[model samples]
Target: MVIVPILLLLLLPFVGAQWLVCGDSGNYTSNSTYQANLMLLSSTLPNKAVSNTSVFATATVGHAPDIIYALTLCHGDITDASDCESCVAAAFKDAQLSCPYNKEVSTYYDYFMLRFSNHNFLLANSTEDQMKWINLRNTLNFTTGGDSITHLLFMLLNSTAQAAANSSRRFTTSRLGVNIVPTVYCFMQCTPDLTPHDCAACLQVVLKHTLKFLDGAQGGRILGTRCSMRYELYHFYEGVPMLAIPVVNGTTPAPTPATRHNSRKRVLWIIAGVAPLLSILLCVICSVVWTRRRRQGKVNLNDQAATNRPEENELVWRLEEKSSEFTLFDFSEILHATHNFSKENLLGQGGFGPVYKGQLPDGMQIAVKRLASHSGQGFTEFKNEVELIAKLQHNNLVKLLGCCIQGEEKLLVYEYLPNKSLDFFIFERNRTAFIDWNKRRVIIEGIAQGLLYLHKHSWLRIIHRDLKASNILLDQDMNPKISDFGLAKIFSSNDTQGSTKRVVGTYGYMSPEYASEGIYSIKSDVFSFGVLLLEILSGKRNSGFYQYGDFLNLLGYSWQLWEGGTWIELLDASIAKEICTSDARRYINIALMCVQESADDRPTMSDVVAMLNSESGILPEPNHPGYFNLRVSKTHEFFVPCSNNDVTITEEPHGR
Candidate 1:
């Protein structure tokens, strides 16, 4: 009992912090003019010494149509110059990425704001002085997300609002112990000019929004227009005491030992009573379902009209749902299906995202993605994928099941394929032996068909911004299915291309036009396919690629060897071990044709399909591929050895 009590006490703070971290987004874009103002204020403030605080920020430009401004602020407790500067710089980098092109972007980090606008910066601080005026306090609108919690949260915010109104420092903080802890933590601030009542009301509005926008977060806030309110379950502010003014009735809530004790007792009794009953009920139900499973007859539901009715994503279920009528799998069903997402079910990892194998309660299998909380980018990617894949349906595409997003927890459910990704056989040291020439040809053709569906044949034309071997999901018979449409783009029927300042795709596989200038089109995808084809032939990645001899990347190396009639040297030794010489040469020539420098020079998907399916067509000698030979050094032995399109690096030679 003594040890347990001591352990509980020590874990209290850590538990609170962990809860805060899990429910919180590592970075969020600031959306209000008040955020812009706060950004300017923080930027002007000098870094301070270590005290009890920190600071944060981000900048935005161009999208929201606002004036340029900058912001910089430290945690109220910060009193050290060096730490403040360092924290501010760190905060700025994070914000810059989160709000890359928008005119009004801001995000919160551990501490500090590095916000700025291409259009405006607020210069309004009290007393005709700039520096000291900016140091008052840093407050943001905290949204806890919902009615009951929101009301209480706003009430606490009013306390800080009232303090800021009465103080000369334009800073005020209030402690609020609510939800899960016993201590209070809340803050409010302004540009040092607003009245107490104005600050109170302004903060209240900001707090309400914060709760709605970031529900269940232990600590989060909104940067707003006139004033801001911030609250965390944990302590966040630090500084010398400022003149204080209370905002609420003098009465504090009465002690609740009786209520808490009753609640605990009730919870224990309920658990004790419910666990056995629920287990018994579940076992009976399972027994019934299993009995039903054995006697159930297969329903003939294969007609396109009968089973593949075109709901928003109805066709996805057609392929993945077996016979339509998508069944909702219980949490336990998925758990049992995947053997609890076991290591043996593990498929692959990228940017730390792991794919697990699962078997449904009905004996159907699935692939589950248990995303990393630290991979904050995965959240947006998840949302983007859900929106797109749910609407896309085609024979060559992978299927997306319903996703699970509770608080910071995120999961992607997918149709499980028995054969796994194409990269497994192409890239692994010994796996290629299983892939004979005939299977390799089928896999290559399947990928082309999938790309055609995305770029032209499907209901919505999509640009699979990222295309590589690993993303090619394989079925039981080794037929290829395109996966990971997270970065894919949709265009109107007539649209053929789009542009993005922030281009993201696998490096070596990107087209010259897309990589060099951020331009993309169906033709751009063709460029990628050509690179993929070359990699497939050689089982080597073009990006960060290196040969033992003088070669920059796979593309350049292939070109060098082909130009010298030694292209056979570039083939995957495994493929070279058995491929038909004529077919292999034809594929190599076609791949080169697809990678021409000019996007217009590349063949259309129609032509690519025709070429791949052809046997007697006279093929032209191909031109040099676009972005042909960018290369790098590979000193890291543990570096990822990518099979077809898995990016690999080569050592940098001393001379050009």
Candidate 2:
């Protein structure tokens, strides 16, 4: 019998133990042909990293449709070949287990990184999706000399980036200040294949993201497939810095009086000698360019107009008279405020994209939503928001302070609410205490008033197609403010409802008619409001409410409890102790009424407000809600039914 060594077994757990997995899961099935390719690719990647002299390798397995692209990279600090190989191997195994059937995944181990995807992420265009950022929870703010510390930190980062770009290893470590007590430590790297210019550009991009997101952060990293950056108050990396930044008292030392006088004399002599020659060269070049343009004037006009026409269509928002209430923010200003959309500045991710917390130069806080390029929100939706939301004013609704549009980038700026969203408090077990019964009631009433304004009093008859807890922002005082008008629809005075071939909304919150038949009205909004109401009351997400047992969603579960005379069980325990039984029951009954099977059976927002506010009236009983089954099949095709965690059916539905 073969004997296994005890020492090797003992050391196994210690090898590549510290690591993190990130990136979104791709759509791929398990135990399939593609899955086989992924498994084969993962196995191949570790061996390639071990065998390769550079400790980096990329490989592709299988053909076309089922093809898998895989790559592995070892940090320059990992000098031991065996250790690098072990890290790669561990990353491969962990990535497969952690991400399961995800077709695109990345795992970062202490000594190495392993990434595999069905797409060609090595290309420059695909790098955006492969980017990830990590920020230390701790912050550093020097009370006495803050500017000097900040200035030194950035200088260190910039110098290190330049060194990494020029190095053959495509990696560099840097330190700020002397060995006695360094102000900061930084490490940077890029894939070896990138040219110096490309590597520098990539690092600069991440630096911009860091600037916005890591302003007061003690440590952070912007990790990407092609390039990466990490900095900290103390040395976290394995090796000594390849470069060191000298500490400046303020600026570089000034030249002596004699040296300055000599320098000025030399500068004057050079300028006097070159001025005439420069003037002649400039005139000749300008004359030739003007002659060529005059000759091609007609063709240039036709070509210019053709190209400019499409840009004009995209830039139509610029034509709108800029409102003082909603400034048309410049893209540069937005970048400055949000640190180029740094991940650390991220408040939360919504259906459209990530929202970031930023502060203007004047110290006014703002929340910026940088719309994802691939999101469902298009130019039409952006225009709709700027046109509609800006015109409608309500204290209960979130204020859109401004917007930014430049090239492919689109962003919306709003007044920053410090308490975050309602979901941030209600969904978390510990945080639910921050919002008691009185606060929850206040939130519910505020939402109803916002909806009332949209349906009856606002300038536009708006239907907020997607309404959920996450979309509800809370102020410093915990007052709720309705937000996100991307999916909202406008209704004319004469029209009460609208129909479309495409349906879009959060799964449990979507009205049955809207989800099943692509029809939405003011009543659809009311149905969504009911789902939000139930969520607030129960402190559970309707999307994954299976924890409540047997029930498909919160609506069905609430209905079951109401029927059995055990409805009080649905109240979030945090609030249940103090909530008045009768008042809670009335709110639940009204919520049930809003989610009735037929849209016609649902109350108007105004009526809902009245019912919630009334003290001495017998409310009508609610009927069965639409799609209130105990079981829904997890299986789906085309798009994951629950993937968007919502149904956005593109095909026409057969009406019941």
Candidate 3:
């Protein structure tokens, strides 16, 4: 493995001169205003680019016809800021000379990219008109592992693209190894200004175009104005790669012909000499340990039994002390309040259990969630909700009065709201008209504030892994309150994210990273909030919206409308005329930003709340949403039936 990388490095090709593309948007005379503005931006952007953490900067100089929009992006792995500045500074000078008097130009160097144009290409949604270049080293191809090598290369490229899109710098490098082929190194990046979806899309297009010309080449690169990808048999970029996948054990090289006989003889001789002694030693150790454990087992069991009951009592006492109003209800009292758990008092059925409407002895109405004996969510989730929600207090959050754990039954008691959940109104056609623009706006802001509190201001930082309309309860005044903390996760001050092998979340509301990779953070909740916000605005369920046009979900349909400048078409007909267009657009933009493909790209709950409350300010353009192309067949519709029940998925979904 060490020898392979060294040999490949020695065979690396020489770095070449810059590549340039003069745009078709016309040219400027030597002394024109456009030329002067371009000069001004060129002088300042390199310094700005080097100072920025992403090593990228954008500047617009002058106004109207003379305005020049320029962008400078340095290679992400370049460690020294001065090198980045110098590379960018050199690109500006080269662009003017190479494209001579062109008002619009794109220049690419080995270490940086610089582009300026008369038009705002920064706002472009498509890369069709952008510059594209493909470079291939045709001298070598994989003689061994043929199809496997190709598969590995493409897999590396795809994963690299995803990592780059999710990264704050919009850049990533990866390497993978296989015994039949030399280790492959890949580099991928996009301009920082592009949305995560656009970045991924751009790289996908570049890969498709580049693959047409590769034809088993040992190394190749496809470069474009928005995104770029390169893969070679040697490490090509500076610093450690962001991802590295070593070869499987069986894939490692076997002993050579000359060494095979000697290696086998040496291995056999060692095993023969060591096997009998190891077996005898292991048996002796096991016998002694087993005898000791057997003598202590009864004593340990007695001690554990003595301590267990006290610990359980102490835990219950601590929970009661934490919240003064928390009460442990008697099973008989619960049965009487809900009229023997009658159907008339039944509220709704959830993934974990069924809820019942009950009136306490004091005449205060309450909602009782009875945990189902056979639920996938069991005692752990019930206990989690009891501890978590009891400590959290906010106007938009549902109030947990107490809990009851008696025998085999576990029950949570919450202050009941007469209007049920947001899904009851928003999803049903007949009930949709009841929620006007004002009510929807209030509900959206309320949910944002609730999430903000959970993520930032609460006693414990919480990530509500499953947040959807069904989890949002509406009061008599039609105000929203976030409920259901069964799947919530607590984060300490230093923790920013977490991962799990068992991914759990509603299908349409799950973030791309969480659903596919089992990685989640506060951003996962933000993505769910975005889906709920859109549902409120459009009076539609994301999972059920696939029947419309060719779009697979609400996210894709809304994005297309927003991109085409016809976003008004996405507004619910009930509130279309009642709400101001600007407010509606702002809400839609905020929702889109929340549902961005990359978790890093999604706004924090605080940011979401600020955006929701502010009537003015230019919102950032949202990238295409996560799961924009997730397709479900008619037979598989049962997976996401668009009902109130939130499904907990143990197995990872096939795609996002």
lDDT of 3: 0.75
Better of 1 and 3 by TM-score: 3
Q: For this target, which candidate reaches the highest TM-score against the unseen true structure?
A: 2
Q: Would you estimate the TM-scores of all the predictions?
A: 0.47, 0.51, 0.50
Per-residue CA lDDT of candidate 2, range 342-410, in tens? 988998877778899999989999999988877767655666676677887998999998887665677
What are the lDDT figures for the candidates, one per model? 0.57, 0.72, 0.75
Order the numbered candidates by lDDT, best leading. 3, 2, 1
Over 4 Å off in model 2, which ranges? Answer: 1-315, 545-547, 632-656
What is candidate 3's TM-score against the reference?
0.50
Per-residue lDDT of candidate 1, residues 359-478 (tens digit): 765776778876776643344455556667777787678888766543344567888888877777776657888887778899889989989888877778888877877788888888
Full candidate order by TM-score, most accurate first = 2, 3, 1
